[model samples]
Target: MCIYNNADPNSGIQSGGVYWAYGPHNLSNQFGNHFVMNNQYDGAWVELCTGYNGTGKGESIISAGYGFVEDLSPINSIALGTGNNYPCSPP
Candidate 1:
């Protein structure tokens, strides 16, 4: 149940950069990944994430645009959903 909205410039996301979310599902304990709309635009910037997918509200920049995403990381973790936990990083 991870979703992102890029309607506002104050969304804290990189103006035109792609966003990615990685984490485990609440009840299923499944891992998943989410990428923002990969549209072509000038002066695009993207923000990196940890727990939940979707760029947060702060520190944005022009999107440089990344292409062809393929990762096997989630295959070993859990899928993402509304019950996902942000900041999944271990301290």
Candidate 2:
């Protein structure tokens, strides 16, 4: 799974770019920004980002690369908003 936080000054991440992210257990809700990406076995990715990162639904998920299960918290699996420059260029 990938997450691109355009305005994330802490991670120094840029927009229009894809990144693989893991559990954000300690992610802060200041301004309510953060993301949790899940790489399913179907070669597809599931991304969840929300205002508190669903602290209540915090659970563990098994990573693809490593069989180890990492702590994961499910958030607003809904797409609250979309980027303006969507319909991205063909990869």
Candidate 3:
């Protein structure tokens, strides 16, 4: 279990100081991804995306109140409070 801070748009692939938890060194592992809801913002959503900076179509959005415990081996990046960007809401 790892905790990633808020991601910075400037950092691109290396955003959020989360590299240590989700960096290239650890991303290749076949471990399943898990995310817990720690955000206080109402209606906030966490997203697991295939691209950096939380931009792309193949994104899995986790709602503000839910947690993710799935095989996210294919995802490379994550973000919080990015629900407005994606057309589909978190499932």
Candidate 4:
């Protein structure tokens, strides 16, 4: 996943990667709407969480090959995986 500091998605400071998984990957001090690029392959997906370490409520699901400009203010973490059992929100 590539997170952009700008909402335009076309250009901005880009960060993040495909290596992070089952993480609380806390976005400290990050605010406003940003562009998130989900580059995961093989049907893998990403989940945005409200709490740290894959806890709390699940916010949104970013499927592979999809990208969106989302508000990062309420999102505290992210989880990457495939299948029904999500690492951020179980069951």
Candidate 5:
């Protein structure tokens, strides 16, 4: 996944890429709206969570090849992959 620092998709600059792996990658003080792109191949997906290590509330699912601009202030961590145990609903 490519995470952009800016919310505007047209001009958003990519902050970094998150590869597919078993994760709970924590965001360090990220705030405001940001652009997130899920570029994984196959049916891989990502989950944004409100707490660290894939815990907490307000989870969101992003499927492969999809993107969105959203307020990430409440999101503290991200998990990569697809499974039945994920807290968020399928996208």
Candidate 6:
């Protein structure tokens, strides 16, 4: 999910470039505040950027599993990689 500001992909704010992300977790520091997911991908990684039109410092791999970012930290520009590779069975 590529997050964009002003509802324009050309003006991206951040990205959730991963398979799936759940829960209330912070991505990392160096990212802008939450706005809207301008784009979403099903079978690919979401590329994150610090600015619009793919600008700013980029982090390709944010996580690899059901990952979570540091607590109380600034949200990162993007989160990458697949998720739920290993699902937990019923308790």
TM-score quality measure for candidate 3: 0.50
Off by over 4 Å in 1: 1-37, 53-65, 70-91
Using lDDT as the measure, name the better of candidate 5 and candidate 6: 5
Superposition error at 68 for model 4 (Å): 0.5
RMSD, model 5, all Cα superposed? 2.5
TM per candidate: 0.24, 0.21, 0.50, 0.82, 0.80, 0.26
Model 3, residue 91: distance off in Å is: 8.9
Can you write out model 6's per-residue Cα lDDT over 5-34, one digit (the tens) per residue? 433445544444322453222344433333
Q: List RMSD in Å for every model shown.
A: 12.9, 13.6, 9.3, 2.5, 2.5, 11.6
Model 2 lDDT per residue over 16-46, tens place: 3233443332233222343433334434323
Global local distance difference test of model 6: 0.35
Q: Which stretches of candidate 2 lie over 4 Å from their true place?
A: 7-24, 29-40, 43-91
Q: Rank the candidates by TM-score, best first.
A: 4, 5, 3, 6, 1, 2
Candidate 5 off by > 4 Å: 10-17, 87-91
Instruction: For residues 1-91, write the lDDT of model 4, one tens digit per residue.
Output: 7788678877765544334564446666657888887887888888888888767888888999899988889888777778777766642
lDDT of 6 at 16: 47
Alpha-carbon shift of residue 30 in model 2 (angstroms): 6.3
What would the per-residue lDDT of candidate 1 be over residues 13-36, giving only the tens digit for each residue? 333232244333221222233233
